[model samples]
Target chain A: MTDLTRLTIAEAREKLRAREISSSELTGAFLDAIETANPHLNAYVKVTPEKAREMAKASDERLAKGEGGELEGIPLGIKDLFATEGVHTQACSHILDRFEPRYESTVTANLWADGAVMLGKLNMDEFAMGSSNETSYYGQVVNPWKKEGSNQALVPGGSSGGSAAAVAARLCMGATATDTGGSIRQPAAFTGTVGIKPTYGRCSRWGTVAFASSLDQAGPIAHTVRDSAILLKSMASVDPKDTTSVDRPVPNYEDAIGRSVKGLKIGIPSEYRVEGMPAAIDELWQRGIEWLKDAGAEIVELSLPHTKYALPAYYIVAPAEASSNLARYDGVRYGLRESGKDIIDMYENTRAAGFGDEVKRRVLIGTYVLSAGYYDAYYLKAQKVRTLIKRDFDIAWADGVDAILTPTTPDAAFAPGEITDPVTMYLNDVFTVTVNMAGLPGISVPAGLSESGLPLGLQLIGKPFEEETLFQLGQVIEDAAGRFQPQEWWAS
Target chain B: MSVDIDTVKRVARLARIKVSDQEAERMTGELNGILQFVEQLGEVDISGVEPMTSVVEQTMKKRQDKVTDGNKAGDIVANAPVSEDNFFVVPKVVE
Candidate 1:
């Protein structure tokens, strides 16, 4: 059996209901994991032990009275980007060093109501900008899985690195993570855990700190697909607080788990097999395809010809929106403020002091793209490419492809500081960003480990709101995916 | 593929971040390198293309135009480097 620390939410819940352990005991074991793992991994910026215990105590009361919700006293780490009433959500930047939120986000509020306790805020790249978590002011998150024969520090992907690290280290059963462009999935891929970014309009963004407001959607990072399903159901709601939130009814996510993939159509976009990808990863992708074929699914060769342009289009569109959304943080507004000589200077000084280097870099890039001389040249050109990229996926789905398969990142996690050139760093997200740009649902399931034993994930991208297909096919691949879950931290 | 240092200084000032001359000199080179790399987007011609202003299809996420302050007065002011009551404090306007 897996250690209590690394048990999935389903496993833990079953154990709790059968009186194998109390809620407090379950919470304690995970909390112990957090204490042991956090120092080494730097996954959490804050660990709320007392608050976790209090929630666990409440769960015990609910159980004793024969009342139970989906996630009773399950502990998960929250990315600091989510606003929790009274929790200091710094976004891992010095600008909000003393910032505290007054109200919880719709997602965080829903998790609290579902009886999920937070293990406190996890670290992230400042304002969720970088592909790697190294840009976080707090520090970089080391990948929990080490190279089999080497003792080097590796990166757990980001800007959701903390969530992935904590999950891989068995610090939390699951974590709340957001993906603007592969923030959740890439990190999960790096750390050998499962992370899902649901359909774009599925989750409310009212209280979550905005990145690219349009692309940011929060979901769960867990050990199994079912745990992700249950957490997804509990968190999905038509939140009227966020105007961008859709009024769609939540689906019975877990009800569909264990459903068979008798005749599903999976797409392998011809373009995704990039020129320089590793042979091991190429073989792993092929293996996942073979598993689906054995399960009676049809493998179709689809073309998203414009897939090559996804990264460039995304960089333009995301930063363009982010430039505008982030304007709210100017000194006089809600975020941190810096005093200056006059009103104008105040805006200048405050923002100057508040934002970190990467945030500023993005702001500048965004501003330049939106600038008069360049607007028509850069921003407009990128948008046109976006339309073509969407058409590529639209054509594939039209060609009877139920879902598309690709590697989450080109390869497994890299060692720290290996890729310093920002453009090279940006290229790491090549396969994952396309899904976000097209506003589709995509998931990273652990395919297998690399030759040196680092994790590799097979990304399955489905049509928008077609997450059900992804989950069904995932079950088949997961059965054959031996040793996909994290090896025990102690065993190392 | 070189960016003028003066242009970097101007962009930095526009961004409202205070960068030293030495930093600006270094950043000018870095920014030039980044721009040169990002300039690859210009390789594809996109005549008559409209800009994608928002990723989410929504034009704006609006709430009711109610006549009430955001209401979390204390919490809003807590992060202020300087605050008084429910408002952020700044230098007095002499005008």
Candidate 2:
């Protein structure tokens, strides 16, 4: 038979329902794929084979009874950011070394309720801080996609890099990822995968590791738009655990797939046309507009004047929130601890040893901005700028614009160490952070290949709680661009 | 809005993260670069704009003032680096 690991979630779901394959078989195939690919890709930080087998067996029994959940028998990789009960829940940071949670995140709990099997915890940037996976204490996750005939390994964009890489490499049908500022969408662009960061509260933040509380959101990464849609339907819900989670009914997002975009207004923000963007990214974005236009979407040229300031403002807001949220890691409750002569000294020493450089830098930035003399000049100013950024989107929505389209990243995935300057590295989120700032839903669909044979993606930004619209528009781009997958160079 | 070595050390202390003198010197330049980049926010006129407290407009949800979850002290400290009788063990501070 064909590789069961290669089947999309929708296809695998049908096959399992028809008894064409068993959940055990499908789960085993993914486990085998992960076992083979993980050493090369470093995508999975921990593989839960026994737990997967146990879950698969339960799913098989449920399937036999004609009573299965929406994601029945589907296997997925969990980003390490989510707290899985009795499982490693590190956010790819040494600070969380050997930490296991007794509680499950509301999002992952929802997935399990739908009968999705957990393959393992995927790697991510430490505390989901960096754009590249280099900040991951577990090491960088290699992008499965390679430049044409080049042996050099590329970074799967982060901090959802492992989620994107695993889906592209077929280690899991889909994976859970979170975006504080473009973590989900940017990495999805780097790999040939579909990722959606639903509106800020679409998924509960109950047990996911907090990066930037106000900006962080959980979403899914998958090989196909339909798979992402399916995963999201099960992932999103209003939870009492997370007050920010909207009290809205979870729509069947899968139905939005293949929905027509006839007469829809697609906004093309002129501000996204940043200076010095590569010609290929611009061309791909143009192609996305054309694709929508051909599908009956009226393109409107618009401007979000605050777009240029979004990144700078985000650096302040996110790190400020991050420093506050991360203060809980005081070396007393859980994870790694370094002893000192006193409690305060111990806290300092533990955090110093536990956190990586990027985390430390951001924490210090946060502390400085929130300090006695700088709060108004820095933190409050960034918040005011954030208001202007959100106003830009609110205006666009009020003008009857259904969704906005843009290139997901400024360029295709780069090789690790290609860019070192922290400010330079932050530009990766240029196209994505605005969605988070505005509390909007955004989806990245692989649209084309770079001149170097790397995958490029186009993003769709929708209004709050309008993830279905993004899924619909994302399918249009997916159908137009077709799928881009890497050759199995690592499958030795 | 540039950060000096002294400011970097002060911020690191406030953040409760130890930084060596050498690391603080390097961090000074890095933090200054970021602070300079964000200084552009000063240019945007915000005389009337309110600082956004939340992205989505929602009143804080109130729940009944009753116990919902409890009696899991063991689980709470299950992963603690050092624990005794379900209580976390930390360095003594009240000596």
Candidate 3:
């Protein structure tokens, strides 16, 4: 039989319902694939085989009685950011050493409610802080896609690197990921998969580790646009535990997969053509515009003047919130604890030894911005810039623009350690951060391959609570560019 | 705005994360690099914009001040690093 691990969520759903494959049989296939490929890919931080088998057995029994749920019997990898009951839920940080949550995150609760089987916890940047997954205490996740004719390993983008790599490598049907700035979209773009960061408060943030609370939103990374839509429909819901979650019905997002983009106005921001952008990225953006135009959609040239300031402003705001959010990891609480002579010294020692360098850097920067004298100059100013960034999008929408399009990342995946400077690394979120600043939904769909044969994605930004439009436009791009999967080299 | 060694040290203390002199030196350089990059934000004209804290414009949900669910002390303290008699243990604050 062909690899069951290679099936999409939709494909697996059909086969499971037809009684062609048992849920346990499907779960076993992925476990075998993970056992063979994970050592080289490093996509998963921890594998829960016993838990997976138990869940798969339950799903199989449910299916036998015609009681299958939407995600019944499908194996999915979860990012380390989400809390799974009694599982290793570290956000790939040493500070969260040996910590396991007794309760499930609301997002994961929703998935489990719909009968999705657990594969394991995937790796990510430490505290979801870096552009590359290098800051993780478990080490960096290797991208499955390599430049043609090269033996060197490349990065699977960060924060959700493991989630993207796992889906792209066919280790799991799909994976859940988060985005503060561009954690989900950038990694998806880098690894040639589909990722969506839903609007703020679209999903509950109760059990997930906080990065930038106002900016962090949960979404999914999957192999196809329809698969991403399917996973997101199961993932999103309102919760009393999260006050920000909107009390609105989640539209059946999969219905929007084949929706025509006819008569929709797509905006192309002039400022996204930044200086030093590579020609290939520009060509990809142009191709995306042409694809939408061919689909009977009107393309409009627009301006987001504050776009250039997004990266800098994000650095200020995200770290400022992160520093406040991450302060709860004290020695007295759960997780790692280093001994000291006194309470104060104990906190200092535990935090100093537990956090990675990148995490410490962000914490210090956040503290500096939110400190006594600099609050008005740094934190307040960044918030104001954030307002302007949102207003730019609001204005475009008010002018009848249905969605905005841009290149997902400035470039395709870079070699591990290729970017050393912090400022240069921050630029990876240049095209995607404005969406977060506006608290809007954005998605990266694999559009085409780069010159070196690695995949590149084009991003579409949608208005608040209008993820359906993005799915519609993303599928148009997906249909035009076709699907891309990397040749299997991890097994070799 | 350059981040000096003392500023880095002060911020680390404020954040309650211990940093040695060597780590502080490296942190100073990285923090300065980030601050310098974000200095461009100072140029934007924002005389009347309000700082956006949350993106969704919704009123805070209100409910009666009643305990909906609780009293599971074991579940709450199950993951604590140190617990005694179902209470979280911390260093004594008072002499």
In terms of lDDT, which candidate is strongest?
Answer: 2
Query: lDDT by residue for model 1 over A105-139, one digit each (tens)?
Result: 89989988888877789989888888779989889
Per-prediction TM-score, please?
A: 0.94, 0.99, 0.99
Candidate 3 lDDT, A267-313, residue by residue in tens: 99999998988888999999999999999999999999999999999
Q: Which stretches of candidate 2 lie over 4 Å from their true place?
A: none
In model 2 chain A, the worst 10-residue window by lDDT is A1-10
What C-alpha lDDT, on a 0 to 100 scale, does residue B21 get in candidate 2? 100
For model 3, the local distance difference test gives 0.93
Put the candidates in TM-score order, highest first.
2, 3, 1
Model 2 lDDT tens row, A1-492? 339988999999999999899999999999888888899999999999999999999999999998899999999999999999999999999988899999999999999999999999999999999999999999999999999989999999999999999999999999999999999999999998999999988899999999999999999999999999999999999999888988889999999999999999999999888899999999999999999999999999998999989999999999999999999998999899999999999999999999999999999999889899889999998999999999999999999999999999999999899999999999899999988988899999999999999999999999998988999999999899999889987787
DockQ of each: 0.46, 0.88, 0.81
Count of residue pairs whose backbone atoms collide, per candidate: 0, 0, 0
Best of the candidates, DockQ? 2
lDDT of each: 0.80, 0.93, 0.93
